[model samples]
Target: MAAGGGSASDPLFPPRAFSPQGRACLALGSPDGRVRAWDTQSGRLRHEYVPSAHLSATCTCLAWATGRPTKEGPQRKKRKSEAAESVEECDLLAIGTTVGSILLYSIVKGELQSKLTGGHDSKVNCVRWHQDNGCLYSCSEDKHIVEWGSQTCKVKCKWKGDSGGVSCLCVSPDGKMLLSAGRTIKLWDLETKEVYRQFTGHSTAVSSLMFITERPSSESQPFDGITGLYFLSGAVHDRLLSVWQVRSERKEKSAVISFTLTEAPIYVDLAVSENKEEPVKLAVVCRDGQLHIFEYILNGHCKKTITSTSIVQIATSGKDDGSVPTPIPILAVAFCSDKQSLLLVYGNTLQPVIERVSLKTSEPHICLVRDIQKNLTLKMKTPILKVKTPVVKSETKVLVPGIPGHSASVKSGSSGTPVSEGKRKPGDKEISIEEQLGAMDIDSMKAVRRGGLPQTDSFAVLLVQGLESNDKNILNKVFNTRKEKLIKNTVARLPVYSIVPLLHELTTRLQGHPFSALLMVRWLKAVFVLHASYLSTLPDLVPQLGTLYQLMENRVKSLQKLSRLHGKLYLLITQISASETRQDVTDVNQTAKLVYEEESSDEESEDEMMERDSDDNWEEEEEREEQDVSADKEINGDSDPDPGEESEEEEE
Candidate 1:
């Protein structure tokens, strides 16, 4: 795989997307611009589609968007054939091509819905679907990130940066934040359509971005205090996997935990288990046919870092029998719905294959069991039946690009085509504007303060109100929102006077709801971070801080003891289970031995009985033979006289 070069004959690692709604099927694209949806469980192709306008274009990326029901228009009727296959509830799939066009396909209709074009001038690298709003985001080599309306295929807004063209894009779960990466990574606020924060770490262009979502525990008291955002970024050129923590700041440094891989990774994905005990699993597909998996858990105590506990690497190059892996280049890897197995797509385009690999970790080595039954070959051709699509009256809106932070030009027109404008040297209009502003004097300016009541139901207002009133329910609302941005904004905008009250409310809440220790501690830390400078100046707040510290200390002590107990009990139970298993095996062996001995004893007794019967029969036969011999002696004497008399009578 390492020796191969980028040629037409070489195998292509195309992008793949699994259905988010059901996880029943996944869409895989090929270099020749063909997309195939395969059943995740059965590994059978449900439908194969080619973009209508992309006859010669190459596919670069794929994304599956769950269909959102809208009252804006009636749903289109799916064909009976497609409905029977249960694709009527299927979602939309967005496919990016090298021709700078995005093809939207309807899984229900089994056809292309619309072709979004002219947003990019170069090959599209990444396409992400925001399911919350049905909007589509795509980044391209043209150095622009374009946002397209869901119903209208027109570009809503276009963003460009000078960081050597955005190569990858990631949308936060709430659909409020967007992450674009190239030479540097930039987090964009989707609501404001502005770069919220930027991060610098990877020396080369980033190839993949995945958000690591920490699912809440299913326990009676779930860990509901995950306030920090964590994601993973990897660059093929840099050969590094970086874990980044999203912060409300201007810029940040490299990833918290930087893991250098042996081979350049082509794709990366994160799978969050529903179980709280299971760590967030990350899978990286490397160029050397090696799939590296890292399981990490976010430590709320240290919100900025994740505990990278277990790492397992398996080769995706061998046959399904877990044979010695060949050096075949792997194209892509995806976590199955079960999270315990992986769906791997390797081999060349001519004989492209998809296989499910079940992974198990032992003490020293990871075991891989390839599911031969689910190994699907993607080389088969399914005849494409063209479905007639109704004519959609498209209203193309003129794209007004925003000002560039880096050296970037705004693209305009219906197709999002780049409208080149000459660089203006502070033009006459700008000079006049500056002169008008400079001409205004202090005497002409009057400060105006507009007073209005804040929205009582807003997150910030509710938080402040809750702090003043000590309303646990209101505070729970703020916490239960689970929106990290809202929480941060509320904390940052908290009034200086209410700082003590906020602390008091947090302490009181902690006392009542001890299960929310993580949340309470995190809020306490945030308060200190924001008001550490002024907090010491006020000696009156010292008592409250002390009390809070004591509460946390007690909680920590108890938690430590419980952790030790859990560990000991787990070890003891495991040993007992092992012993019991051995005992059962021993019992089975002894039972088999006893049964064998009983059968042998029974056979020996039967043999002795047969010997006794045979001896008795021999005695009886001897007595009968002696009696017969005496009878024969008598008969012979009589027979001799008859024989001679009969012979003389016959002669006469």
Candidate 2:
């Protein structure tokens, strides 16, 4: 399912909700070189493109930065005098891809205007355009937030810190304070680019942040001392919705109060009502199935101290159990206020569903009966709430290109133009969109997803969708996802599908990434294990064992080449050492003998050295004979020494 709130003007799919600017539409980036645009009202494909065809990278994030048209080179754009008045320009869609590149596509022209690369070393998280002219901000998991000049397509400045990778960021209404939401919320002065205040209330990583105007219109009433700089932030886990009051003059942020809902919030968006009676409210969808609406109320000197008290206002149909809250998570939410207090919510169902719940009479109650108002009336037309997790459903679309208004003048290269920088023969054929679609595995293209991971990560969701899908083009999308993920875990989770198709895909999808060999080996091992235990029982699969043999053979050949190179490197290193030391002998015993010979030469000739080492043998013999003769003279004292010993001594 798609996550993140769209412009206030647009609602979720079947996009009936509208703003004066234009009808709401959605731009979705997928793995198969397509950026799809869908009409919000009719839930139909509007525009699609394959800007970076050779990149073959999955889309990570998407943003619309409304500003003056980016200046394409003289060849791409028309002169001001020749401009057509019939066409209206829209905001540029900054499609952040998995390869750390951004595509600036003109939604109006339905063509690529510019492309950016190498600004971030990792996948782009969020790309937001400051209301300021031509200024945009992009953040990545690489811990980099780069400000870009949309017109020049160049990085203007970079901001980084120890607080860690940026999860989300929101610009204050005044455009002075840039609040970054991560493990902690940091307020940075946009001009100085210095972090002045760090909000530490959140103990874990925060998912998103948005600024809300607390005060009413100046024409309606005056909020003399009220702080206008307020923001709402939510976390990725252990979620709490914190409403912060920013006192820029005081250089501080005070957490007015936070509510710990039953589930961690997946997305948070704020909407203000034009109705004079209605206050500013927040719309949230959580991991656990639930839809929440909160109103920002200020009282008692703009209170700083917080409490754990619940500020819940669940809309139940009956009077008997109006207090209990249900955990039905909404897929998308829109707080519409042309003149009415309506909240539109979409659920995960077989077909598309949009449930509108009126909140005009819903006054929040803190403690049960102490603050109960007239009544809590809600029309629960559908029961879509799940107690445990977010509701997710699969979306399967065919690979047909140029859906309706979307035209495919596919472009490539760093500039997002049709210029060819890659090596190509003059007569080489440029693959048409049809051929590209034909090349993809058609069967695996059917996508399915079921959890929170898919909501945040474009790559994971797409691959998991393909893994569980029944389309032949599964390899095209799944390969991009599988390249980064663990092969073992993915193979274990994949539903029974044709392994032969996916294995053939590894040849193309596994290119341009590191550790391809390792991934292939792990994949082969998993396939073998699955085949022996389970897939082997199936009929035509018996002949498919050749796929496993081919994988193993390629692996063996690679290992052999690797070992051969290793031996060559070792031999070269050993030869260099031997040449420097002048030692030809490698045998341990030979080395020992050589050392001994050197020592023997230092002392004397070999024979003389041994005799010297033995020492005084003849002197000992002569001494023994003399002692024996003396003992014979003193016969009684030394009867042991005999005549034969004395004779032998004389002969010596």
Best by TM-score: 1
lDDT of 2 by residue, 1-652 (tens): 1125322111221111122133255554444446666555565556777765524455655666554544556575666654532122456777776556787887778899888876887766666667766577777778878888887888889878445777666666666767777667788888989987788777776666777665655566764322555667776675577777766466455567675676777655556554435655666666654556666554313444332222333332334656563333355555544423333344321122333445442644321112113343566678788555322222222233422211223333222323222343466656566654543433322332222222333533444556456443654444433453455556665555645555544544344354665555556666667655566654456465565556557767898899999999999999999797876656455344343346655866789867975677767888999998987768767554477988888899
Model 2: per-residue Cα lDDT at residue 352 = 26
Clashes (candidate 1)? 0
Q: What's the residue-level lDDT of 292 in candidate 2?
A: 61
List lDDT for all candidates, in order.
0.67, 0.56
Tell me the lDDT of candidate 1: 0.67
Candidate 2 weakest lDDT stretch, 10 residues: 8-17
TM-score for each of the candidates: 0.49, 0.47
Residue 363, candidate 1: Cα error in Å is 4.9
